[model samples]
Target chain A: MSRLPSVRSLVAALAFGGLGFAIPAVAEEPALEIVGMGSFHVGGRLAEVSGQPPRDIVFTPGAPPARIDPNGLYAVEQMYAQWFKPRTERGRVPILLWHGGGLSGVTYETTPDGREGWVNWFLRRGWTVYNSDAVERGRSGWASPDVWPAPALHLPVGNPFERFRIGQGEGSYSHDPAKRRVLPGNQFPTEAYDQFPRQLSPRWTTTDQPTIAAYIALVDKVCPCVIVFHSQAGQFGFRVAQARPDKVMALVAVEPSSVGDPARVDVLKAVPTLMLYGDFIEQDPRWPTIRRTGIGFAERIRAAGGHADVVDLPAAGIRGNSHMIMMDRNSSEVAQVIQTWLQQKGLWR
Target chain B: MSRLPSVRSLVAALAFGGLGFAIPAVAEEPALEIVGMGSFHVGGRLAEVSGQPPRDIVFTPGAPPARIDPNGLYAVEQMYAQWFKPRTERGRVPILLWHGGGLSGVTYETTPDGREGWVNWFLRRGWTVYNSDAVERGRSGWASPDVWPAPALHLPVGNPFERFRIGQGEGSYSHDPAKRRVLPGNQFPTEAYDQFPRQLSPRWTTTDQPTIAAYIALVDKVCPCVIVFHSQAGQFGFRVAQARPDKVMALVAVEPSSVGDPARVDVLKAVPTLMLYGDFIEQDPRWPTIRRTGIGFAERIRAAGGHADVVDLPAAGIRGNSHMIMMDRNSSEVAQVIQTWLQQKGLWR
Candidate 1:
C-alpha cells in the first residue's frame, strides 16, 4: 500500500487551521471514494414462547385496546452490521469493527466530541469498513425479559469517569469541572466527557452465547478479514479468531477487558494479533488485572507459535491515553500506528 | 432536479437480475459519490440528582466494586444525528428523517428484509439525508429512573403484527406462519415480519419534552429543509415546523399517530404539509381515530391559508400498505410517490 503523506499533512493542517497559513485548505484533498455502503443483520434464531397471559393494552395513551398475544414465535439475538466499501482498496481484507459492552457500532462511527471516528479514519485510508452492533445492543434487538431474564447493567456517569482513567482514581470525578480530578496529561477531552455516555447502551450478561454465535456467523459471511475490537469484545475477537483462524487475518484488541480460553491458543497460530492497551492502566483499580489477562493470553499465543504483540501505549511513548484510546485526542495518530503495523505484517495490499 | 431514468432501470434490473440477462452489470453504473458523512449528538441538559443511595456494584460478573455516585450533574436527554452528504445535490434543502416511538433512526435505514431503506432511497435521489435518534433512544442516552421516573413501554411481538396492519385483525397473528392470518394482499413481507422488532426500542412516556426540545434543536441546526417523519414522530414534526415555520420548507407525516397542538395550528400556515396514510386505516381498530386527527389538523392548516394534503394510499391506487409503509414490499414505489409530490411542490431544485 502506498502511504499518503499528503493525507497526514492535510489532517495536521486542519488540526491547526489558522496558525499554519502555508498549508492548503482541506477541501483541496480528494474526497474519500466509497464504492458501496449498506447494512444487514446476521445470526438470531426463532424462539417460541407459550403459556403467557394474553393482555389488552393501548399502544398510545388513549388508543383502543390492542391485544398483545405473548404466546408466539419471536426472532431474537440478531446482530446488526453496516459496511462501507472504499473504491480504492489498500488492505487485502476488510476491517470488521466490533464495539465494547454497553455500546454499539456508534463507538466506531463518530466520537462523543463530534469528530471523525475510527471507521471513517480507516475508510479514508482505503479499507472496507464493517461496523457492527453486537446482539442485544443498538439496532440488534433484545429478547423478552422471560428469554433473557437478567436486567441490563448500566454504567453510572462516575463509573466510567474513574474506571476509564479519565479521572485520576475513584472519587476523582465531580459535577463541577473545577472539582473533577482529571489525570495530568489525559488524552481524553474532558469537556465532552458527558457526551461519551450517550453512545453507551444497556448491556446484559446472559447474551454472550448469542453474541458469539452472531459474530461467528458474521465472520462466516465476510472473513479472511481483520477484526478491530475494543474492551469487552476482546474475548469475542480472540474466540472468533480461534474458531476460524483461516478467516481472521489479524486481530486488534484495544484495551480488551478479557481474553479467550488458553486451551484454544494454538488455533490462532497463523493469525497475527495485537493486544493494544492505553496509559494509566498500571494505576487503575481493575485495569491492572485486566491487562494481565490480556498479557497472559498474548504469552500463551506466542508459545503456541502464534504472532502476538502486547503494546502498552505509555511504554511505546504514546502517553496520556485512557481506556478509550480510539476516542482519545491522538486517535488518528494511533490509527496510523495500527495501519503501519498491518502493512508490516503484509496484510495491507 | 433531473430524474435519472437509468437509475430506476438499474434498480429494476438488479431486482430481476436472472430474468433480464440483457441488462448491464450493476458494476457498470457509476458509484454513488459521498462527499462527506459524519454523525453528532445534540440537545440535552445536565440534570442533577440528589438523595439517591450510594451503592457499590461490579460492572462485570467478577469485577471489583465500582462505586456508583448517584448525586451529580448527569448529562441526559441528548439526541444523536448522523448525516450523509451526497456529492451531487438535487433538493433545494436537506431532508431530515425522524422515526416513531419504540424505534430509533434505524427504522429509516436498511429494511428488516435486507433491502435499501428510505435514507439511501432519498440519498440516491440526491437529497442530503440526516437520520436522527430521538432523545432517550438509540445512541441518545437515557436519564436515570430518578429523573424521568416512568418505565419505558415495550411492544410485544404480536403488537405490530396486527396494529401495523400486517395481520387481518386482532387475533389474526400466530406463531406458526400457516396458522397466522395475514391480510390478503398485505404489502409487508411476513417472512421478515419477525425481523421488524429488531429495530424497536424501549421508549419512555415522560421523555416527550426532551424529545421535542431535541428535535427542535436538530431543525435549528439543519433547516430550510423537509422533514419526513413516521408514526409517533408526527407530533414532533408538526410541533417543530410550528416552532420554526420559515425553516421547515415542507413536512411529511407517514401514518403519524398524533397531531400537534390545535391552538398552534396557525403557526404552520406557511409550511406545505402531507399527512400520508397507508391501507387498512378505515377498518383498523384505532387508525380511524388517528387518521381523523391528522386529517382534522390538515383541514385546520388549510383553513388558516396553509397547504396540507392528506393522501390515503389505497385511495391513491397504491394498496396493501401497513403503518410501516417505509419498510413495505412496495416501499420504493411509496418513496417515488413522495419524491414526485416534493417535485410538484417545488421542494426539489
Candidate 2:
C-alpha cells in the first residue's frame, strides 16, 4: 500500500512510541489525497398537492409579483449521501457513517469545537467514507406537513446536556457557562458546548419507512460495506444490515439508543457487530435501560452463532464519555477502539 | 505556484485545445490535495422558550421515557460553512459560495443530475472555497415556531419549472414526463428535472435580519473574500458587501432576484461586482421586471463609481440559460465566464 506521510500520522506515531498503530492526534490535519468525491440522493417519492389558496407575493421585495401555486407534484422523503474515495484502499468495504436523530452528516464531518471528525479519521485509514444526512434532515430536504403529519421535534438546549451525560444530571445545564455543570471527568469539551446545538437538526417522528428505504438503496449502490452509526441511527444500522446482509459486512453502533426488530435479529448473525456504550449511564435518567436493551440484542446475535461485542467504556478502563461519544474530547481514542475491532474481524485490509 | 496535473485539467486542456485558459470538463474528477478542510458555524442568538406544554414520548420505541422540554434558552439562526483549502493557493482571496432561497450549500455541490457543481469548479482552479448553508437552512438549524411564527414556505415541485425558465412558459409543466414542455433550447438537464425538487428546502419569509447578520458574521470570519451568490441571496450579497466593503473584495450575483439597499449603494464603490442574468427573462412573467431592477442596481453601483458589469447571457451569445445557470447543462461554460471575469479583475492569480 502506498502511504503518504501526514503530520497527523507522524504525531500519532510519536505519541504511540512505535506501537505500530496510527492513533490520530487532536490537531488540524493536512488535506487528504483521494481518488474522488461526490454526492447523491436516494429513496424519494413524488406526491401531488392541491386545493390550496394561491398567494401572489414578491419573491424579491421590488420584483414583479409571482404567484405561489400551492398545488403540484412534489418530491419528498429522500436521504442524501456524500462520499469520498481515498487514493489507496485499505479496507475491504466502504464505511457508511450515519448520524443519530435530530442530527445530520455534520456529526461525522467536524466536531463542534472544530476538530477532525470520524469521517476524516476513517478516510485516512484507507476506507472510502459515505457520510449521510437521513431523510428530512440537512441536505435531505423535508416534506410538507401533509406527509409528515406531526410537527418535527426540536431538542431543547438543555435536553441533550443532561440526557447525553454532558452535565451532572437533570437541571444541570445553565445559560450561564459558569453555572452549567459538567459531569466529573466528562470527556466533552464543555467550553464548546454552546456550539454543539448548532449541529442539532429538527427531526420528524414519522419517516422511518422512507429513511430505511433510502438506507437500503444506499447499501445497494455501494456495498458490501460497514456501517458506523450513533445514537438514534443505531436501529437503522441493524435494520439495514438485516435487510441487506449480503451487502453489510460489519456494524458499529455508538451509544445506539435503539436496536433492530427482535423478531428479525437473527438475520444479522453473519454480520460482525460492535456496540459501544459511554460513561455515566448508571447516573443518567434513561441510558441504563437503553444500554441494557442493546446488550440483550447483542447477546441474541451471539446466540445465533454470530459475533457481537458490547463494550462499556468504563468497564473497559476507558472512561469520561457521553452519549455524544463522537463529539467528546477523547473521540479519537474511542475511534481507535473500533478500528482495532474492524482489524480483528479481518475487515481492515 | 505548484500545479498538479489532474485528469480534469488535462481533459479541459484537450477540450479547449490549449487556448491557454483551462475550462472544466464534464466528468467525475479527482480529489484535491489541500492544506486542510473543516467546518464551523457562525451567527446564532440565544432565545428562551416558556409556557409550552411538556410531552412525554419514546425517542426510540423501546427506550425509556425522555421528557420533551420545549422550554429553554435555545440557540437559534446560525449559518454553517464548510471550507476546502487547496494545496496551491491561486487566488488572492478565498471565494465564498452562498446559496439562494429554498436551497442549501448543496446548490454548489453535485448537481441534481450528478454533475460536478461550481464548488469543485472553483476548487479545481486552486481557489480556497467556502460553501455555506445560510441561516435556517440545511446544517443551519431552524428556531422553533415561537421564534419564527410563520410556517416555512415550501416550493411546489412545478413552480421552478417555468419560473427557472426550464419550461416554455406558465402552465408548461406536467407530472407526466412526455407531456412536460421545455423551452425551445433550454440548457437545463430537463430529464433530471424530477431530481431538482429534492434540493429545495423549507424557507421562512421573514428571516432577513438573522440571515443577514449570520452572513455578515461569516464575512468577518473569512475575508477579504469573493462572494458568489444566486437568486434570493442577491440582496444579502449586496447588503453584506455594503456592510463590509473592506472585507468583501468582489461580488458575483447569478441571476439575483433582488438588489441591495438603494440608499447605501455607494458603499460598494470599492468593491467589484458582476450581475449575471440568464435567457428567457424577457418573456417571463416576473424576470423582466426583476432583471430591470437588477440592471438598475448595477447602474447605481456604476453611478457611485464602483465597477459593475451586468451581463445578460443571451446577449453575450450564451443562449438557452436558466435561472439555475450553475446546474445547467453548460454549467462549466458559465463557470468559465465567471472565472474569466475574475481573471480580468485581477482577483484570480
Candidate 3:
C-alpha cells in the first residue's frame, strides 16, 4: 500500500525555504446584495389619560435661548426597527436582534471600537437582519417621567469595565490609563473603554411592564422570526417565545439577565432556545443568581422535550469577551457560531 | 445654560411616528490599504544526522498504478509565515499569530463558521498582520516519523465538541445531530460542529522540543513582534518571550491549555503579557489546574514588576465563547479588545 507522504519528504519540501506552496484558487461568489432596506415602527397605543395639548416652554433670562414644544410626549411607546434583506436569503426565517438595557438598535450598527457590527456581518452571511430599538430605548419612544416613572440612572464611569469584566475588579478604572487595572487578558476595548459610559441612556426602574407590552406587540407584527435578545431584553424575548411558540422560530439569548417563569417553561418546549453568556459573569455578584435561574429554566425546557442549548463563552475558549457580545471585537465570530447553530437546527437554508 | 436634552424631549422626539431621525453622517475615511504582502521561512538547523538518499518506489502488479518519491524529508522544520503590511502602519509592531495543537495558521484565517477572521480585521485596523504555521504544522515541514515519535491517534469524532465544550459532555456528540448534548449556552458553531473533526491534523506528543526551537528561531527572525498564541501554542509562545524578552514586545495567550514553568516567570517581567480564558473552563476536568498555574505565573510576573493581565472571558459578560477564541464568532471582538489594550500600553501607535 502507498502510505502517506513520509515525514522526510515533508521536511525536504521545507528545505526549499521561502518557497510558498501555491494556494489553490477558490471560486469567487457574488457579494451579498442588499435587495431591500427599510425602517418601521411597531407596538404603540395612544393614551388619552390627559386632555393636555401641545405647549411651548420658553427659556427664562440668563438661560440660553431655547424654546421646547413638548406635546404628547411619552403618550406612546413605539419601538422602531430597521431591516436589511439579502438578495439571496440563506436563512429560512428573519433574525430580529434586540438590544440590552440602556441601549437600542445602535448596539448592532457600529462597535464601540469603531468597527462594523454584527448586523452587516449577518447580512454578508446571506441573512435578513432586523435590528430593533426596543420600547423606551433608542429610536423607540419612551414614556414621559410624569406618566411612566422615569428615574434617570447613570452608570458610574468605571462600572462598565469592572462590571463587564473588561477591566479588573473595583480598582480597574482610572483617570490615568496607565494605572487602570484591567483583566490581564481582557478582550474589552480598553482604549475606548471610557467611551462606553457616554453611550448609556437614562433608564427608568419602573418601565418594565410597558417595555414588555411594546416588545410583545413588535413580536406580533413580525411573527415567525428568530429573536436575539441581549441583556434586559432576555426575559422579554423568552416571554415572547413562550407566549407564541408558533411566532418565534427560535430564541438566541445573549447574556440574558432573566427569563420567563421557570415553572411554566413547558410552553417553551416548541421553541428551540439558545442562551449565550459572555465572560466575567462569575465575578458579578448579581449574574450568578441570574445564571442559576436561567440554567434552571433551560434545564426545565429541555426536560419538557425542547431544544434548549446553553453557551458559556468563557468555557468555549472565547476569553476576555465582554457583556456586549454583539459589539465585541470578535462579534462576527460569535455570530458565525450562532449562525452555525441555526443551520444545525435547519433554521438556516 | 442650555442643558442636555431632557428625557421628555428624548421621548418626544422619539414619538414622531414614522419620522426617522436622520442618522448623523459620519465622515468616511479611506479603506485600509495593504502596502505590501510577503512570505518567508525561518529557523531550521541543517541536520547531518543521516546520509540517506532519495529513491522511488514502484507499485506492484495488483496494486493501483503509483510511483512514490521518498527522500530526505524531516531534515528541516523551518516555520513558514505570511504577512500583510497596512499602508498606514498605525501599529508600531507587527502581530504574529500562532495556532493551537493540531492546527496551523488557518486558525487565524477564516473561522470554522466561514467568516472574515481576525487576520484581515487586524490589518484593517492598520496593523501589520503575520499569520504563521508553526514548525511541523501546515506549511511548516513535518519531521520524519523516524526522527519524531508520531502517534497515529485519531481523535474520537465526538471528543472535540465535548472536550472543547462545543457539545454538552462525553455523550454530547451523536451521529444524529439532534441527539447531540451540547452545553446549554454554548456559542460553538453547532451547525457546522461536525466540520471541526475533519479539520483536525494528527499531532505528535513528542514534538515539543523541536517546536520550541523552531518558534524561538522565528522570534529571532522577526524581532520586537507581538505574539498572539492560542491553546497548545501557549506554552511555546511564553517560552519564546522568556528566552528573548528583547525580541517580544507583548504576548497574548488565548485560553492557553498550558504555559512555561511557572517558577521562571520572573524573566517575563519585561514582556507585558495577557492570558485570556473563555467559557466553560471550570467544567473542564484538567483546565482548573492549568488555570491555577497560569494565574500563579502571572502573579509572579506582576510582582516582579512586569505587566501580566489575566482575563477570564465569562467574567467580562462575554459568555458561550469557546476554546477556539481565534476562530470563535466574536474573534474580532476579542482582537479589537487586544488592540485597544495595546494602544493603551503605547505598543500600538
Candidate 4:
C-alpha cells in the first residue's frame, strides 16, 4: 500500500551539510520529463513527430499521469535540496494553491518569527502543493529564462527586489523584482519612462490560455481534488471554473477579489465550493463593500448549480490581506476546514 | 539633437498599416529591440557579461557607454509609445514606473486599456519610464530553462483556454498552467503543477535590474530622474534608488505594497519622497488592518536624513487599490499630483 519510501530513508539519502545533495536511488520516485517538447519555436515545429513526448517524468501538484522524479535536486541557499518527493502510489489528490497578486505561493506564511514559509502545510497534510515561486516572485529558481540551451531553474525566484537580497540569496531570490521584473519582454531602457515586458511569458495567460485549460484538464484527470485560490488568483480560478465545471471536485476560494457571476456559466456543476473571506475587506470605506459583492457572488455560484457557501472567518490580525489568504495567521484553521470539507465528502484527505 | 525618430517617421519606416504596432519592429523606432534579461539560467553565461565593468559604465539605464549587444538587433515593443518625443528632447527627468504584481508595466496608466500607463502619464509631463517585465508574464519570449530542452507546448500550442475562449466547447481553455508553457528544466513535477516558476517572475525583475541600473546611470549622467512605485513593484524602485541615488532626483510611491520599514536601506541616499495611497484599499477582512507602512517607512528614511511624505487621497473609488490605482477613477488626479509635484520643484519637467 505504501509506494512512497520511508521518510527516514529520504532524509538518510540527502546530503545535509553540503551545497549539493547526493541520493543513491529511489525506485519509488522516477524522473519527470516532457518528451521532445524542447524550445517553443522548435517545439511548435517538432509537434508533428514527437507528439510532445517526455524523456522522463516526475510528480507535481495538479499534474497529470503521476510521474515522479526522486532524483530531482533543487539548489536553495547555495545548498542543493530536494524540494519535492512525489508519492508514486498517488497517496492523495494534490492541492492547487493559487496565491494572490504581488505574492508567491509561499506568501504571508512564514515561521513564527516570520521567517518560515508554507512549504510544510501541504507536505504534512498528505497533499502535494505543487508549490513554487509566484512565477517571477519567489525563490523557485530559474533566473535567466531566455538562454538558448535551456534555462537553469524552472521554479519561482521569490520577490527579487527587497526579498531576494537576504542571506543565502541564491536562485531568483538574488535578483530584484521591480526594476528587474515587470513586463515579460520589455527589458530595454525607457527612451520614455515605461514599466514592463521584461521577457518570458508563461503559457497560461495573455492572448493564450493554455495554462488555464491545461490546469482544468489536470484537475479532471486528478478528480476528487480541491483547489484553493488566494486573493487575485481567485478571479483566475473563477475564470477556470466558468470554463470547465466538470473538472473541479471542489473549490476553496480564500478572499477572492473577483468571482464572475457563476450564473453566466451554463456548464457550472454543483461541486462542494467553499468561498472564504476575511473581515477586513478593502474598498472605498463607503459606497460598495466586499460583503455586498462577495455575498452576491456566493449566491450566484450557489444558484449556478454549485454547493457554494461564503465563510467569513475572524481576522488573522495582519495589516492587510494583500490578496493573500492561505498563508494567513489562521491558516491552520483554514487547513482544518478544507480537510473537514473534503473528508465530509469522503473525497480522501 | 533628436535621439529618436517621430511617429510619422516610424510609421513610414515600418510601412505597415497597423497604427497600433505589435511585435513587428518599425525602422522608425530606433530599431526596436525586444531583447530581455531573463532568469540567470535563461541568460546563461551571457548575463554577467551584460553588466560589463566599472559598475556603471556598461549597464546604465538609458544608454550605456558599451551596449550589451553592441551590434546586435533585439526585438522590443517600443515601450512608451505614447509620450517619448516630447520629454526626452526636452531633457526632462524620466519617471521610472515599476509595475504591480501579475501585470506588466506597459499597462501602468490604465488597466490594459488603450490609454497611456502611469509611466506615460509622467512621460506626457516630460519624464521617461524604464519599464520591463519581471520575467515570463507578458509577450516577452523565453527559451527552454531546462538543462535539457523538451517540448511542453503540445498542450499550450494553439492555447484555447484564453479568457475570451468562451463557448469553445470542452477543453477549450483547458491547457494546464502546470504542463503547458513550462520550459524544459522543470523535472520536479511537484512545483510544476499549476504551471509555475510563474511567467510572473518574467526576465527584467532581477537580471534586468542591473541592466536597468546600467541604463539609469547613463540617463542620470545626462539627466536627473525620479522613481515611481505602484503595487508589487514598489520594493524594486526602492532597490534601484538604493543602487543609484544621485541619478534619482526623487520618488513617487503610489499605493505601494512592498518596501516595509525604510530604516533597512543604506544603499540609497536621502531624497524627496512621496507615498500616495488610495482611500479605497483592498483588505482580507479577516486580517488585522495593515496600515500604509510606507508612510512611516518614509519617515524612517527621513530620520536617516532622507525626505519622505505620506499623502492619502480622498475616496479613490478605485477597485483593488492593491491592483488598480493608476487606472482608478482618481487616476487623472494621481497624474495631476505627480505633474504638480514635478513642476513645483522645477525638477526638469
Candidate 5:
C-alpha cells in the first residue's frame, strides 16, 4: 500500500467514441504511473484568478491524504460505498445517512433530539452508518474556484448537466431558510435556490463547485459502508447511485421526496429504493404542504415502475411517526420495519 | 408557428442505437404541421402498470395549459407567466418570480397586504412579472412518470451509464421546464423554478437523465427579456448561462447564494451578472451564511476569470434589507441598482 494506486481519470477521448474526461498533468512513479490531468487550484479572492492545474493520478491505497481530483467524473468517486464511520471495528457495514432539508448529513445520524438518528437507526441493526454532507450543506467542500466546462449535449456526455459544478448548498437558497419550505416530494431540495445570490455569490455557470464525486472517493478510500438517505440527501444519493451503481448494494431511501421530473424515473428505477412515508393524508389543507408532497412522491415512485412498497405506518404495524419519523418514538419500530423490508427485499442478507 | 418544424433526426437515429425508449408519436399533417412536445397536463393521474398502448398526443393550443413538472425544478409554470399581467404599459421590465425552499413563486409575489407581490414589485416599477409553483407544488398539475430500461450496470465499456427510458414532463429542469430548477436570479422574472423535471427526479442521477438539447432549444427560443433570481433559481440560471450563454443579455441576482460548490463558475464569465445581497448586519444568521456561499460562488466565477459586480445592499445605503429584500419595500431600490448596474455594464439598453 506504499505505492500510488490506480486512479480513475475522465479520459475525454472522443473516439467518435467515449472517454469521460482528460487528465492534464501526469506524474510517474515505479509501479503505477500516476497521470495528473484536469486539475486546478481555487483562488481565495474573487478578483484573483488561478491557472488550470493538471490532475494527479496515483494508486488508490498507498497515497497519504489522498487528493482525489476535485473535478473527477462522478464515476471515479462513486466506486466506493458511502457511510458514516469510514474507519471502524471490522464488520461494521457502514451506513451513510443522507439528510433531509434544513438538516446536514451529521444531523441525519444524530439529530438535536437523541432519538434514533439515521445512522444510529441502521447502526443498531448491525450496520455501519456513514453520514455525509453534500457540498455547501455540511463540512464537505466543493470543486475548483472556477466553474468547469460541462459536457457537450452529445452521446456519452460526461456530466452533461454540469451537476458536478453545482454543489447543493446556499449561494443556492437565497430565500430565507427559516422561511423557505422544502416540497416533501421535491426532487431537488434547492435546485432553484441558487438564483437568489447574496451580495457575494458565484454564478453557477462560471463556478466549478465540487461534487459528491470527491466525497465519494474520499469515503471509499477511507471506509466500508452501506448508503442510507433520509429526505434531501436522497437526491445526492440518487446521483451517487448513477455514478457508482455497483458500490451501493441496496439503497434505503426514507421518503426521498423527489422534486425533479419523476418522468425521468430512469435513474430511480434500478436502485433498490425503500420509501417510507408517514400517514399523511393527501389534499389536506390542514397538513403541512411538504407532507402532501411526500404522499404524492410515494405514489409517483410506484408509478415509475420502481418497486415502491408504500405501507401506511399504522397498517404496516410501524409506530412513532411524523414529518421526520427518524427521531420519533417509534424509531426502533421503524428500524425493524426497515430491516424487515430490506430482508424481505433481500437487501439485508 | 403553425408549421411543423424539422429538427435534427436524432429521434430517428435513436433506433440504430437500440434505445428502449419509445419515440414520441408524431402526427404529420401537411396542412397543420404542428411539432410540439408534451407539456404538464394539469390534474392528470399517472397511469399504473406497463402496457404499450396505442398512444396519441393531443396537441391542444391551451389544452394542458402552462403548468409545471412536479419534479420541483423551476418555480414558475407556463400558467404563472401567462396569467401574470406584466405592466408592460408601465416602464418596468418583467420580473419572473421563482420560489426557493419554503416559498412557491407565489410566496415571493404574495404579501400580507397583498399589494407588493414579487411580480408586483417588478410590475409596479414598470416591469412585467411572472411566478409559479414548481411542478408537484401548488396548482400546476403535472405528474412526472419515470420510465426506463432495467439498469444492469457494466455492459459496454464505451457505452455511457445505462440509459433510462425517457420519462416525460417539461423535460429536465435544467434543460426542460420538467426536470429543471428555476434559478434564484431567474426567479425575479422570465423564469422557471429549479427542479422542473424535464423527465427524471433528483432522487435519480443527474447524469442518467436524458439530454437537454430539447429544453435548451426552448430556452434559446425564450428567456431573452430580463432575468432576476433568488436562492435555488440562481443555480438554474447558472446552468442556463452555460447551456446558452448567448441567450442571456443581462442578469440580476438578489441574495444569490452559492451554487453548493464554488468550483462551478465557468459559464457566467461572459454573461454580465449583477449580484446583489441584503445587509448581513441587520439580517438573520443565515444572512452571512448567504454571503459566505454567495462570495464563495462569486469567487469561483472570478477564479474562472469571469467578472461579476458585487453589490452589498448595506454598504450601498440600503441597510436592513433581508435576503428576500427583492420582494420587500426596498425592492425598487434593488431594481434601480440592477438597472444602473446593467446600464453601467452595458446590458440595459
Candidate 6:
C-alpha cells in the first residue's frame, strides 16, 4: 500500500485532483479507490524558547524498555489529521469525523467492539473522509504542563463504565466476575469490554478553547464539508458550524452529550444539522438535560428556517443501541441509516 | 411443530417437569421447545341486559360477500393473553409482555421492520412468555362509547413522528416523497413507515382505570412473573407491581413515556425495576420531563435499598437506538443483553 512515488512524481500526481495510485481492477477488489492519503498538523505555534538541552534516557529494557531524548520539544498540543480521498468521489462534501472525550480519531477508524467503523463505512459509499486526532489527542502532539499551561487529565479506570452506564455504580469496577454488574439492556459489546479501556486517552477540561481553535483550523483546511461529531466533540462540531456556517455543509451529531449556545442558533441556518441519539439516555441523570439543550438549539434553528433533523433510533423501531452507535454489532446498519439520510440531504449520490 | 397431545397424555407428560417435545439434535434447531401454549381472557363481566341484544347485521363487504352476526358482546374490555411455555423453563419467572399506546400484543410479535420480534427472542432464552393484548386494544376487546364513559382516541398522523422524534414537524406526513422529511439519525425503520401506520390502534385517554384494572387482573392470573412494559403500558406495569409486589418478580420498562406517582416509589422496594430508554429522548418536549420523573423514582428506589436498574443504552456505548428497542435491527442482540442481565439477577438459570 505504501509504494511511494518520488516528490516530483507526487507533485505531478496532485495535478489530477490529488490522485495517488490507480488500484488495479480485480474481481475481489472494492469498487472505490483511495486516490489521496496524506496528513498534516494544524494550529501549532513556533516554539519561542528553543535550544533546550536534551536528556538521555534508558535505551532498551531487558530490565529496561527503549527510551531516548526525554527532554526534547516533544509536546505541542497542535492537532494532527489524516485525509483519505476517493478516486470516484460522489459526495458533494467530505466528512470530517471528530471523536469524543478522552478519545482520538481512532474512534472512527475501528470501534471498541472491533467492528469496521464509520471511516470505512463513509469511504465505501464514495465519500472522502477526514479523521482527526484533535488537539492533545492520539497522533496529535501531547501537552506537557510545562508547555501547555494546564496538565492533561488522566481518565481513571472504571470511569468509562460508570459514566457510560455499562454497569451500575461501583459494581462496574468489581474485579470479581460475579460482582460485575452490566446494566440491563446495555447495547454495548460487553464481550469486548477489555478492548474499550485501551482506547481511552488523557483529556483536559481547560483545553477547550485551544482545542476548539485547532478544530476550527481543521475546518478552515477542509470546509464546505460535513462534520460528524460524537460525544465530547459534539460541542466542537456545533461551535465550528456556528463559526463557519458557509463552510460546514452539514453537521451530524451522534449522541452528542453537549453543545454550544442554544440562543445563537440562528447562526446555523445555512448548515443543516442532524442529531442522532442512542438507547438508554433517559436513564442518565446528565444526558437528558444536555439533550434538551441541543433540542432547544435545533428548534431555534428550525424557527430561523434552518433544516435540523432529530432521529431517535428507539422511537423509530431500532433499539438496544448504546452511545457508541458506530461500534455496536449493528454499527454498519446504523452507518447505512446515516448514509441514507446523507443521501436524502443531497450530500451524497 | 404442532403435535397436540390429549389431556390424559399431557397429564402423563407432566412427570418430566412439564416437558413437551424434545428439541431435535440438529444444529439448525434452537435449544428451547414450546411445551405449553394456551390463551385466556382476564377481567370481563357478563352483559346484564343481553336479552335485548340479539340483532343480526351484515358483517362482510362486497355485493356477494358472506354475512354474519354483527351485534354481539364485542364491547367487553377484558384483556386477552396467550402464553408460550418452554419444555425446560430455565427462567424462574415467566415474562408478561405488554403493548404500548395505540398498539396491541402485536407490538411484541413481528417488528415494524419485519424482523422476528421480541416474543421469539425471550422464548428462545428458555422463558415462559405471555403476550397480552391489553384492554381496549387488539383482540382483548374494543370498548364502545355506549359501554365505556368516553370514545376511543385516535392518534393523529405526525404526532408520533413529532413526539417520537422520527421527523421534522408536520412534514413527516407529507404526501410527496420528496417533501417528506425523516429525522436524520432516526432508528425508526423509516422503510417501514408504511407498515407503522398500520399498527396504530384506536386508543382512549379515559380508559386508563379500566385498562389498569384489566392489566392487574391479568397479573393476578399469572403471578410471580416478570412484566415487560413498553411506553403506555409502563404505568400499568408499575401499578400492577405495586398492587401485587410479591407476584411480580421483576419489571422491565422500555421507554415508558409516562409512569406512576414518584412519591410512592418506596412501595416498589421489593420488585426490581429496569427502565430502558432509546435515542433522541431529550429532543422530545414531553420525554425529558417524564424521564426526569422516572429517574427521580429510580433514585428513591436505590435510596430505599431497592434494585432499580436504569439501562441507558446510549451511555453504555450502544447508539442510534430507538424507543422500540425490541424491534431494532439488532433486536436479538439487545434481547441477549437483557437475557444476560436476567441471568445475572438470578431470574434465569
Label model 5 with its docking quality class.
incorrect
Model 3's CAPRI class?
Answer: incorrect
Q: In terms of docking quality, how is candidate 4 classified?
A: incorrect
Least lDDT summed over 10 consecutive residues: which range in candidate 2 chain A?
Answer: A1-10
In the range B308-333, model 5's lDDT, one tens digit per residue, is: 65666555555555445654455555
**Residue B34, candidate 4: how far off, in angstroms?**
20
Off by over 4 Å in 4: A1-349, B1-83, B87-91, B135-144, B147-223, B260-269, B282-291, B315-322
Best by lDDT: 2
Chain A accuracy as TM-score for every candidate: 0.90, 0.90, 0.83, 0.49, 0.48, 0.82
- How would you encode candidate 6's per-residue C-alpha lDDT over A240-287 as one tens digit per residue? 788888899889988776676676788988887878777677876655
Off by over 4 Å in 1: A1-30, A46-56, A70-73, B1-31, B49-56, B60-65, B70-73
RMSD of each: 7.1, 6.1, 28.9, 27.6, 27.9, 28.7
Q: What's the residue-level lDDT of B312 in candidate 4?
A: 52
Which of the two, 3 or 4, has more lDDT?
Answer: 3
| lDDT (10s digit) by residue, model 3, range B1-349 | 1223332343244344211222223365224455444455566543322354433221111112222222222234556666666667877888988888765666676555666567767777788888876665544544443445443222334556666667665556676788888777777677766445434444455567777887898788776889988877777888888888889988988877667766688888888887887788788665576677677777888888888767676765567887777666767666755765566567765
Q: What is the lDDT of residue B278 in candidate 4?
A: 48
lDDT of 1 by residue, A120-142 (tens): 88888789999999997777757
Give the TM-score ranking, best first.
2, 1, 3, 6, 4, 5
iRMSD in angstroms, per model: 2.9, 1.7, 29.5, 23.0, 26.0, 30.9
DockQ of each: 0.35, 0.59, 0.01, 0.03, 0.01, 0.01
Candidate 3 stretches with Cα past 4 Å from truth are: A1-349, B1-32, B48-55, B58-74
- Residue B22 in model 5: lDDT: 26
| After superposition, candidate 5 runs with Cα above 4 Å error | A1-349, B1-80, B83-95, B142-218, B260-264, B280-287, B303-305, B346-349
TM-scores vs. true structure, each candidate:
0.88, 0.92, 0.45, 0.33, 0.31, 0.44
**How does model 5 fare in lDDT?**
0.37
Per-residue lDDT over B191-221 for candidate 6, one digit per residue giving the tens place of the 0 to 100 score: 7654454345556666777778888888887
Q: Which runs in model 2 stand beyond 4 Å of their true positions?
A: A1-31, B1-31
